[model samples]
Target: MKILLIKAARLKSSASRRHDGVMPPLGFLYLSAALKKAGYTDITLLHLALEGMGREGLERELERLKPDVVGISAMTSEAVSMHMAAACAKNGRNPLVVAGGAHPTAYVSDCLEDPNIDAVVRNEGEITFPELLAAYGRKAGFEGIKGVSYRSGGRRTDNPPREFIEDLDTLPLPDWDLAEMGRYKDFVPHSPMLYGRRYMSVFTSRGCPYRCTYCHSIFGKRFRAHSPERVLRELRILKEKYGVSNVEISDDVFNLDRARAAAVMNGVISGGLNLNIFFGNGLRAELLDEELIELFSRAGVKYVCAAIETASLRLREKIKKNADLEKLRAAVKLLVRRRIFVNGFVMMGFPDETVKEMLVTARYLWSLPIHSFLLFFCRGYAGAEMCGTLPPARRIDPKTDNTCFVPGGGCSSQPAWKLLAVKQLTTAVFYFLNPARIFRIFRDLPFRDARLFWFLFRTMSVKFFSPARR
Candidate 1:
């Protein structure tokens, strides 16, 4: 069967579009590999953002390709766009539309509620998707396929949940050939501390054991990782074949298994593959130690983003973050001393959190020797612990809601506007106090690329000076 998979873009505004760059949809790449293994060779992968395609462009592609099935992967922020793509597919060629990824996995019924979407694949799609296709090929009922939700006789029928893949090493390598690697190279996602011209993202592991309130455990809390040998092989391919000099390790927790993590890093060094690495995904601060930091530096890790959600111990515990402030501070200091760039991921405007609490966390971050701070207003995503507990109206679209400019409606004790003001003030004060960070950023760029400089400047301007206050 001819199949088309689309990775939808979430940006609505022109400004947001400029800031957002397309990262390869690793999920779809794996799915493509799975399909190819299942004997479905006629598969096409389309990344709308990377291709600069809109709904009309997507419709045209659907009409031209005339595929039997179209699968769309999206995050919660891309809900509207997901529906639009599904609608376009349905109207153009009447293909069997399937929706997957974090958003659909969390809201299965909500996604299937759309008439255009024929089914929703939950969680891991590698095994379930192939089975789904087999069922469709045989013209068999989908009741037997696990981990899929579909419409049956005008009623939604959800099959039993599928188990998470225990042996991540067993999965086939992602079908990178199907992706537009050249276009991806031209318009690469911006990484704060990445050094190389050619870069790509790699996931060495799956799942996180931590129970952060704002996080969804779609992969469950059990951590399963690819063996170090398998990881090294992939790295070698990216280096030798793709000319990828820099890699963003996108593991939820890269350092979860200290020994395994160390082994992987050491293997990179031993192999003489001197690739610049950055952990754009936030790493757990409490897990870092001097030994690990040294290993990271030796492994050519240029920068690390640590999840310092909130500095207030009370708030941290309340949110079930369970992070040690002292350990986080030490980690930041050690990374800085080792000449590694440190970026702190800070969140503000919790349900009952006060402006004082938010500022306290902000002040704590500013006091640290970190190179940059990523300030985000707390968003209660679907399937997260906070989503169930928060009032329905309080739940804001994570894509459009700038808690820094508009109040996150979830807070009852604080007005949304006040929360916005605090967020803006905290950002202004932190950057204004540390002008050296600006200089350090310029010094860290591998080459004097105008695009990179413009990205940095635009990002900072939007964060500190955007007139989107509501």
Candidate 2:
């Protein structure tokens, strides 16, 4: 069967990009490889971001490909746009549209109610989609399909639980050939330093075993990994086959299991894959130690980022982020001593959190011996422990709560706007106040790149100065 997988762009206009036009969506590549492995090579992966494609572009592609099935991977942020695309597809060709990601998995009911979305693939789409195709083609019951929810007789039916992939290594390497990789070279992970040229992402493991209220509520608290050997095999391919010099291990929390993490590092070193590994996904601060830091350094791990979500122990507990402040400091010290780059992730605006807690968090984050840090405003996703527990009056409007709402489930409410503003400003306050931080960022470059430097400086300055404070 011909399958068309689309990776929807998160931005409505071209303003969201980082100087560069747009980058290929990685989600589509993963699904394409999975679909290809299932004997569906007649797959076309359309990246809306690179093409600057919108609903009109989606309709045009459907007309061109006439794909038998349409698959969409959307983050909560892009739900509204995804819905528009799905509606266009349905109107243009009526291809079966399926969405799977954190958004859909968490808000299955919200997704099911959407008339345009035929089915929502929950959890891991790597395994779920193939099963869905097989079941559909056989003209048998697709009801038992694991990790999938469908609408039948105007009602949403939750399927039996589909187990997580036990062996991540067995999966096919992502089909990077599907997207224009060179366009993403300059895109860095919101870091102040570093040449944005040369960027890529790879997942060394799946699942995070943390009860960090926000994380568990989004990605589930189970930590699973592809065997080290398997992980290294892909790393080799990334370097040799795909020419990816920089790779982000996009796990929720890599190194949750030290042995597995060490195994991965050992495998990469043993395989002699010459590449820079980035922990773009946050790692647990409590888990880092000298041995692991040294091992990661030896293994060519260039930059590491860990979560220091809150300085307030109370807020940390409320988020279930069982981190140790002392250990976190030691961990940062080790990385700094080794000259390895480090970044910390902090959050603010918890239910009972105060500005003092936020200030303390900032103080603690700055105290850490690290190259850079990111402070984010806490957003309560729908169906998360925090969201589910919110009082009816306090409940976020489903339309605006893009953080956890299923792709295409439109609930345009004021709360989402507030949440978005919170996220933007929290980041602004952390970095804008620290002039030394920005200078540290500028010091890395020579005077010759003044144009690019100023471009970024002005861009960031505008954001820092004019924060979306309500």
Candidate 3:
């Protein structure tokens, strides 16, 4: 049987390209590997955003491929796009249309409500997706299939929850060969620090034990990681076969397991693979120590980001961040001393949080040794604990309504204009207090590559200035 997997574009127009760079869809790649391992060799992958395809182009491709099954991977922000793609793919053919990803995992009923979608896959798809395909191939009843929600006899039926995969070592390496790797290399996200080398993203672990209110959708609290040996083998494959000189570790918490993290770093160092490594996903600052810092520096880690959501201790505790300010400061200092670039990930507009409290975070950031920072308005995405407090209208489409520009919907007591002004003020203060940070950006960025520099500048500007206002 032929299978087609599509990574839906996040937004409707070309504007989505500004946000989604050459970041390959790692989730679909893993699913492809699982399908291949299950003896389903006829599989095709399509990334709409990377291919610059619109609805018409999508329909053209769907008609040409004519797969028996089409799976769409999407995030919460891509709900509309997913529906459009599904409708187009099922225009003339009767292929089974399935939706999976963070959005579907959190809002399965929302996906099943759409006429274009036949089923929604919840949680991890590596094991569940293969089982689902096999059941479809055999024409067997899906009543007993775990981790799936579908419409049955005009009623929605959700099966029992599936258990998480504990042994991550058994999973096959991601099928990068199925994707157009050359096209992705030119448009990789976070290219400034990458030094214009071919880069690939790898996940050595899944799940985070922390209770950060904003991050409860995709991966739950259970912490699972691949063994160091397995991680080394994948790295070797990337280096030898793909000629990947840079790797972006996409783990939620890279240093959660100190011993395992150290083992992976030591393995990279001992293997003589002088690859540039980056942790663009924020890591816990409190988990870092001198030993880990040294290991990272020795392993050629050039970029690190810490998730310091808020600087206000009261707000931090209220949100269950549990990050120690002292430890975070020390960690930033260590990375800076080692010449590793550091960035702080911060947020504003929490429920019942005042402008004063938000400014306190900006002030704290000003006092740190971090080279730069990203300020974001809190988004009460579905499946988050805070989403329970939101009104029905606000919860309808969080992609556009969960920003500072949305009045009273993003959990801010202030008016939309006021909240936006405060956000602008906080960003101005953070950068104004540190002129050296501007010079640092120039020094670190690859200014020689005008194309890359412009791309980074345009993306950053859009994110900073454009509020997701409906």
Candidate 4:
């Protein structure tokens, strides 16, 4: 069977290129690997953003490949692109159009509302996707396929949810070979700190136990991890087989299992891998201690992002982020002391968040030893617990079609302009007051991508001065 898996792109959006760099669509890659393992040989992976393809380019590929099935992976922001790609897929042929990813899994009925999409594979697709394919090949309908929502006789039907995969060790290491590994050379996400040689991302675990209200909990709230041996083996494959030097352990919270974390670190240390590791997604900083920090250094961890979503205790409880802020500060100090670059991940807006709370977070960040920080306005992405209370839709102005120079509306009780003011003021203050941090950025500035810096500037400048804003 000719199977085409497309990584949907937000081609028309002002999506940050620096943030969404040319990452090997790890989810699609895993699915391809699963398909291959299930004895399906005819699989092609197309990354729309990485390939710089628009609707026309996608149409051309659908024509050329003549695929039997077209699978599109998308986030909420890429929903429009997914539909556009699905329309293109259905244009030339009667191939099955399937949508899967955070958006579809979370809002299955809404995703199926589009006539073009035939089905959505909810949650993990490693097993269920192959089962769906086998059923399709056998000319049987997709009725009993667990973890799937499909159009049945012109009506939407959802099957029982599939159980989360327990033994992560059994899943194949992402088939970089099948993914055309060479094409993604030196392409990590567009963080200046993330620039390194031959980068790839690894997920040593699945699931997050903590219910961060703003998170899209596609992976269930249970901590599941590959064994220590399995973790080291995947790294070894990347290091020796693919020559991957820098890697991001892109788990939601990698150190949730302290023993597993310790064993993996010990294995990396004993194995002599020397792979430059980073935890860009973040780590549960409060979980770390002196030993864990030392183990991280020995394991070649170069960068870590301590996720301190808020500083106000009241706000933290409201959002279900139960992080110990005091411990987080100590963790940041330890990371910095070990010469590991640390960045703080913080959010500004919430349902009842006050300017006072926002300032509390800003000031708390000043007390940490983090070399840098990312302050994002909280978005009400579908599937998050925070979505209903703080709907981003109400915040956007149709005239500008942006959460932009928002006049009166905002996601939180606070106005959009107020949140913007707080973010800008705190950001400016954070940097201006910290001469040491400024020096760190410049010292490493020469090694960073100049194009990325300029592109970011251009994107922001255009957004601020566009005729819509004026």
Strongest candidate by lDDT = 1
**Candidate achieving higher lDDT, 1 or 4:** 1
* lDDT digits (tens) for residues 1-470 of candidate 4: 99999987653434445345667788987888899999998999898877878889999998999999999998765777788899999995889888898878977876788888999999999999999999989989998789999997888899999999999889987878766666565354634455434578888999998888888778899989899888888899889988887788889889988998999999999999987788877489989999999999998888888888899999889889999988888888888778787778888777678899999998898877677776666666667787777545643322222232222344566776677677666666666668887666445332357754564355334434333111
Query: Which stretches of candidate 1 lie above 4 Å from their native place?
Result: 14-16, 185-190, 193-196, 397-413, 445-448, 468-470
- Provide the overall lDDT of each model, using Cα atoms, as 2-decimal numbers: 0.80, 0.67, 0.78, 0.77
**Candidate 1 vs. true structure, TM-score:** 0.94
- Residue 29 displacement in candidate 1 (angstroms): 0.9
Candidate 4, after superposition: displacement of residue 217 in Å? 1.6
- Model 2, TM vs. native: 0.86
lDDT (Cα, tens digit) per residue for candidate 3, span 1-470: 88999887765433545345447788988889988999999999888888888899998888889989999988876777788888997787899899999888988877888888999889889988889889998887678889999987788999997888889999899998987765666555643465345688888999999887766647668889999999999999999999887888888887898999999999999999888888888378778999999999999888888888898888888788899888989998898878788878888878778888877887888888777776666767788887787676545373442123233456655566666666666656656556787667656542347766675576455544655343
TM-score of 3: 0.93
lDDT of 2 by residue, 41-157 (tens): 888877676676777667777888888888877666666666776787788466778888766777677667789888989877878898888887786667878888998788778
Runs of candidate 4 exceeding 4 Å displacement? 11-19, 185-192, 390-410, 441-470
Q: Which residue pairs in candidate 4 collide?
A: none
The alpha-carbon deviation from the true structure for residue 332 of candidate 2, after best TM-score superposition, in angstroms, is 0.9
Candidate 3 residue spans exceeding 4 A from truth: 12-16, 188-192, 396-409, 443-448, 455-470
Error of 2 at 385 (Å): 1.0
